[model samples]
Target: MHRQIAGKLTGPVTKWIVLVGAIVLVGIMAPLNGKLIDVQNNEASSWLPQSAESTKVVEQLTGTVDPNDIPTLLVYHRDSGLTTADLAAMDEDAKEIEQIKGVTAQGAFSPNEAKALIASGAKVPPLLSDDDKVAFVAFTFNFGKNGWQDIPDAADKVRELSKIDGVDVHLAGFGGQASDASEAFEGIDTNLIFITLLVVIVILLFTYRSPVLWVLPIISAGFSYMISGGVVYLLAKYADLTVNGQSQSILGILVIGAGTDYALLLIARYREELRRHEDRHEAMAFALHRAAPAILASAATVVIGMLCLVFADLNSTAGLGPVLAVGVGVTFLIMVT
Candidate 1:
C-alpha cells in the first residue's frame, strides 16, 4: 500500500501537480503568514487560566474597576537632593502627562499635589523621599483591551515629558512592566525565523556534506513554517485561538526542526536505494515506501503529545498545544509530499 501510494505521488504528471500545487498554496498563504504577529495577545491576563484567582478577581472587578486601567508610577531620583528647578520641572511634566490621551486625570498625584495634601493634613503616601532625593508621580492609563500594545508608546511619551535635568527618571509599576515586555517581544518572530533558518542551514550543510543539497530541506521547512503560520493566523483571527509571541516562536522552531529531521530520514533512505536501483524515480518510490511508516509514526506521536497540552489550566499552555501540533503536522505533510 505504501509503495503504491509513493509510486503514484512520484509519478511524472502527479509529481509535477503536487509540486506546483504546494507552491501555489504557499503563495496564497504568504499574506496570512505575515499577519500571524498581528493576532498575538501578549497581555498578562491572556496567559492566566480562567479559573485562576487573579483572573477571577479581574472578572469580578470588571464592573466596579476599569479593567483597562493600568497604574503607572514615574520615579525620579537625584544623588544630590532634588533642587527647586527639579521640583518645578516635575510640576510641568505632570501637566503634560495629563494631556496624554489615555492618562486618567482623576486620582493622579504629582509632587505639587502631594505638598497640598500634606498641608491639608490628609494622610497620603509621600511623593518625595524623606531625604528629598527621590520623588514619584502616579497616574492611571485606560486604553481598553489592546492597551498593552499601546503601553510602550505611552511610556516613552511619559519618559520624554518627565525628564528632569539632574534627576534620574524611571518607569515603575504594571504599565512600565508591560511596556518593557512588549518591547522585548517586538520583532521576535522575524528574529527567531532568521536565526532558526541560519542554524538549520549550517547544520544541514554539515550533515549532508553537500553545498547545494541542504537547500531542499530548508525550502521544505520554510514551506511548512509558512503554511503552519497561515493556518494559525486564521485560527486566531476567526476561531479565536490564542496566539502569543511564545507560541508563535515555538511554532517556527518546531516546524523547522521537525521538518529537517524528517527530511534527513527520507533523504538517507533515498541515498541507500539509489545504489541498488538505476532509475532515480523508482529509487525514490522505494525509499518513500520504506520511510513513510516511520515518519508517520513519529509525527503522530509528536502531534498526539502536543494535543495533550490542551488540558493545561493556563490559557497560553492550552493554546500552545494545538499551535505546535499544527506545525508538526504541517511539516509532516510537506515533507512526505
Candidate 2:
C-alpha cells in the first residue's frame, strides 16, 4: 500500500528536495518562535544582555519589585557553622560592598532570614525553608538609583562576592534569579514539544502500522510550528513582545493535538471511502470533502477561545495567547495541503 502511493507520487528527487527544504525551514524558524533562542557558552551565549529594556520588563511583571535594587539573599542554616563569628563573616562583604559603587547594604540575618522573607514583603525567597540549615542575608545593590544596569556594576560585584570561602552562598535576586529560572525552564519547553510529537507518532504507528503514515502529520505539524515560531520571533524582536515560560507548552498542546486530530479525521474518512470506492483518488476526494468542514470548525473554535486572552492584563498570558492561536491557525492551514 505504501509503495503504491509512493510510485504514484512521482520522482523521488522532488520528494527528497521538498523534505530537505522543510527541515532547513524548521531549523531557521525554531529560534524565531522565542522558545529555542539560546546562544549558550561562547560570547554570543550572552544573547539578551542586561539592559534598560530588560530591567523595565522585569519591573512590569513584578510590581513593587524595584529592579535597580538588584537584591540577592544569602541564606545559611544555624547548623552550617553560622555562629556569631560566621555571622561576622558577612562583615567581610561589607568591605566588598563599600568598595563597589551603588552597593547600598550588606548585612547578615541569622535564622531570622526566614521570618524576614515571610514577613518583610520586599520580595519572595526563592529557596526552600530549612531554618536549621540556613542563614540569610539580603545584599541590596543600588544601581545609582537609576535602574538595574545603572548601579554601575552591582551584579558583577555580587558574582565576585559569591565566590567567598568557608560558607556556602548563592547570589540570587532579580538579575541572577531571573537567569536561573530561564535556564531551568529551557529544557522543559523543548521536552514539551518533543513529547507532543511523540504522542502523535505513537497514535499514527498504532493506527496505520506504516512509517509513511507517521511522516505526514509530523511534517505538517513541525513545519506549521516552525513558520509560526518564526513569526513569533519577529513579533518579539520588533514589537518588544515576550513569549513567557509556558508559551511553548501551549503551542505543543495545540500543534500536537490539533495536527494529529486533523490527520486522524481525514485518514478515517479516507479509509471509509476506500472501502466503497475502488479508486484511491476518488476516495481521497470523498474524504477531503467530508473531513474539511469538521477540521475548519475545530480550528475556528480554537481560534475563538484563544483570542479571548487578548482581554487579559497579564502580559505573559496575553503573549502566550496569540502565539498559540497562530500555531493552531498554522496547523489548520497546513492541513489544507
Which model scores highest in lDDT? 1
- Count of backbone clashes for each model? 0, 9
**Candidate 2: pairs in clash:** 39-45, 74-137, 75-135, 76-134, 76-135, 77-133, 77-134, 77-135, 143-151
Off by over 4 Å in 2: 1-28, 34-69, 76-180, 276-282
lDDT tens digits, residues 114-228, model 2?
A: 3556677757553334444555556565553234224324555655674545556765555456435545554676788788788788889998899788898887887887777
Tens digits of per-residue lDDT for model 1, 81-121? 99878888888888888888889867468887889998999
Per-residue error for 166 in candidate 1, Å, reads 2.0
lDDT score for candidate 1 against the true structure:
0.89
Query: Model 1 off-target regions past 4 Å?
Result: 101-108, 114-126, 143-145
* TM-score for candidate 2, residues paired by index: 0.61
The estimated TM-scores of all candidates read 0.90, 0.61
Q: Give each model's whole-structure lDDT.
A: 0.89, 0.62
What lDDT does model 2 reach? 0.62
